[model samples]
Target: MITPTITSLLNAKAFESLVQSRRSVRKFDRSVSVPEEAIHRSLQCALLSPNSSNMQLWHFTWVKSPEVRARMVPLCLGQNAAKTASHLVVFQTRIDLWRRHARWNLEQTPPSSGSESDKRRMQLMRKYYSVLMPLAYRTDPFGLNTLVRKLGSFLLGLTRPVMRLGGRGWQRVLLHKSCGLAAQTFMLAMQAEGYDTCPMEGFDAVRVKKLLGLPAGSEICMIVAVGKGTPAGVYGDRKRLPLEDVVSIV
Candidate 1:
């Protein structure tokens, strides 16, 4: 393992401050406009976040148009954060792109004529993206694929540990989990850039999807409102249960 240096320690402290400073700001200062460039940078940072199998099956829609943003207000339930924010970003999970992404991951492997280690790495990547991903993500209207996965796991685990996989529902949950991490990365990046964000999950998913013209297989993970925050934006002092009660030392 690499030794921790002064730079690493200072970076850790800075990150601790960033995490503490972040809040779910509800009331943005309408007078202060957040730059569009900052949003773009934060989104690029979000794309670098770790995801399942490196599939990167997520999309972000920046609601920049005045007419569209106005229409989104009602879809967001007229929350003050949505109304007063300079920008709104819609985080989405693109489950339909699984096949394409899996193929993309497979294609990223090194050539067959490379070194032995490289060859081994390439083979493992191929197996993961070509065989395992398809089995984990495929679905059917009658739950047949889910039953197959359940039985497969059960039979394989008769003598050893195995992962219990389901069908479409499990796939959806997995995609959302990755997409949510991307959303958190975006929010934290915004905070690091001296802006505030509110992640709102209380929107009408169907209407929001229609407004964005998203595909049926896509899911809206959350809508994040961004801008400079006001004093009233913070609801109260930060509060959490005691560490001993929330965490268990094993």
Candidate 2:
């Protein structure tokens, strides 16, 4: 609510430079540190991300120490970008957070016979419980952890959504598109701040989660690093099939 009331919304053209400037920068000069405040600003932008129920389910871990970064680099498929970049962020989605937030919403009741503080507490409880219940229906978490896991694969179109290979469960693959959007938003923000960046999913999830001490029911969906790009930054070819190939009309 505190965000400014825009007299006009941003047109797609208004965001042209941001869209054009964003690139998966693979090389960086590692001598500098991304200002901690700028890192916070990048994460703060994600706070405004839209979620299934305003649960703000995304969490980010910033890796700043050299040894830790080296440990994580191998986990990320030996990508040196994770080491030398000024910022390395591991973005994750918390199904547990979603489930808990949802159940809390479903369990709320009217303010009981109590003081105003109790009444406020009850009101808050009701709000979250309401949000969570709907999400649970969409997620369908029954006692059938097996069934839920099985169904999650089907729903998410994964061979195994939570197989328990290492971290989290079997790990469904759908998060890249959703979480990738958040990472893209980060890259765009970084670019707008004159920072170059890269996102990597081509790594061992099991290893990276350990490096970050991620909680269970969470998975490292993507990694992003930011800094000034090398003069010979290896940018992939940018090509699109065409609007006719991808767009549709009602």
Candidate 3:
């Protein structure tokens, strides 16, 4: 039998415990206010999440003001979870940030006078723009799918994979995956901090956009509620498909 590596053991011990312990909390005690420090700490964990090219495309807002929660909870299709939770985190994915990052890559040509490390940095920036240029300037780009997405995928059909590797139309999907990962990282990190979380999907997007003052192209993905757990009016018994039925390893 082969022995497990030390790194693998450490990773399993650190992450697996957190994953197993997390639950989608529905019942939150209405009276208790979540500590601002705890919220900040959980967000700090999210800051450490892996992002594409270190682009860090995710933005978060903690909605705790009574007026905002009152208005926002109705947006969640009347889900009391939003109205009652101690805090609601609004996850916004801005497409312009990726473009900004790409632009930075272009503007920040490494000075020719820095260390060897600086020379490598400039080379990397040039390489980054080389890939993002086609993506940034492509006509009829995005297919209007997402306002923002993966860098290389936007250049697909115009660029050859074996030749330069555009990875086809996987950009939008990849962006969604990256953003989703950030969202989950935030939620699970909250769990790790011993706070209960409820991820909500039912909501009025148009109204939410109006409420948030978002421009024409932005879309709301989901809302996450955090607080202490309770029993009354809480979402009951979550049923999921069995792992045997849901997972298939080839």
- Displacement of residue 202 (Cα, Å) in model 1 is 0.9
Residues forming the 10-long window of minimal summed lDDT in candidate 3: 162-171
Query: Which regions of candidate 3 are displaced past 4 Å?
Result: 1-14, 104-121, 133-171, 231-239
lDDT of 1 by residue, 161-190 (tens): 998898777888888999999999999999
Q: What do the candidate models score in CA lDDT, each in turn?
A: 0.93, 0.68, 0.70
What is the overall TM-score of model 3 with all chains considered together? 0.74
- C-alpha lDDT (0 to 100) for residue 233 of candidate 1: 92
In candidate 3, residue 244 scores what lDDT?
98
What is the C-alpha local distance difference test score of candidate 1?
0.93
Tens digits of per-residue lDDT, candidate 2, 23-46, equal 777888766557878878877776
| Candidate 3 lDDT by residue in tens digits, 154-196 | 4653565532323323444445566677779888888777778
Residue 64 miss distance in model 1 (angstroms): 1.3
Task: Name model 1 segments beyond 4 Å from true.
Answer: 1-3
Against the correct fold, how does model 1 do in TM-score?
Answer: 0.96
lDDT of 1 at 204: 97
